[model samples]
Target: MKFLKQFGIILGVSFIGEVLKYFIPLPIPASIYGLVIMLLLLSVKIVSVEQVKDTGSYLIEIMPVMFIPAAVGLITMWSELKSLWFPLCVITVVTTVIVMAAAGRVTQFIIRMEKRQKE
Candidate 1:
């Protein structure tokens, strides 16, 4: 019952995201919007972390299972993807490096801020 309530909150946020997507012209995904909404709600104390923490942790634990269908789809589309494999690989590596660098910088900045606050 508690998990259901938390999951319901998540679904409500996602539904709001979908509605925003319908009205907005941007190509962004509803999932991203929902994530942002969830973050804001938690940060602002509009939604307590404890309310969703357990359910969220459970979902995260099973996240790898979510990729199974994507993996299968890739396998099924191997013939088409084979022709663009080189370019795809290059793009993947480049984007991965960029994301890693950006994340590292962000984490460093946050750590510095926390240290300064403690000093």
Candidate 2:
């Protein structure tokens, strides 16, 4: 009943997004486009929060489960992964460190700018 209604809204928005993708040449993912559309609808009060809250929460709860198949596929390809493990490890570590450092610097810069603005 309630679940069906919420599901219908999600489906309708997703379908609209897919239809829009055909006309738009954006490089972004269609599902992401759908999400932005949904957000815009909520912001404009075109879609009530209560209408989608239950279904949205349910989807969030099951989001991790959606990755199970991908995980299993990765596991099955473990041997191939092991062959490239060294380069992968190096790239992962270097990228992670670079990203963390950049994020921290950006945060500090933002905070300093805000303080200077306040003064």
The prediction achieving the highest lDDT against the true structure is 1
Q: Which stretches of candidate 2 lie over 4 Å from their true place?
A: 86-119
* Per-residue lDDT over 10-108 for candidate 2, one digit per residue giving the tens place of the 0 to 100 score: 999998888888889987777988999999999999999999999999999999999999999989999889899899899999999999999999999
Tens digit of per-residue lDDT, candidate 1, span 15-108: 9999989999899999998999999999999999999999999999999999999999999999999999999999999999999999999999
RMSD of candidate 1 to the truth, in angstroms, is 1.0
lDDT of 1 at 44: 99
Candidates in order, TM-scores: namely 0.95, 0.70
Against the correct fold, how does model 2 do in TM-score?
0.70
Q: Residue pairs in steric clash, candidate 1?
A: none
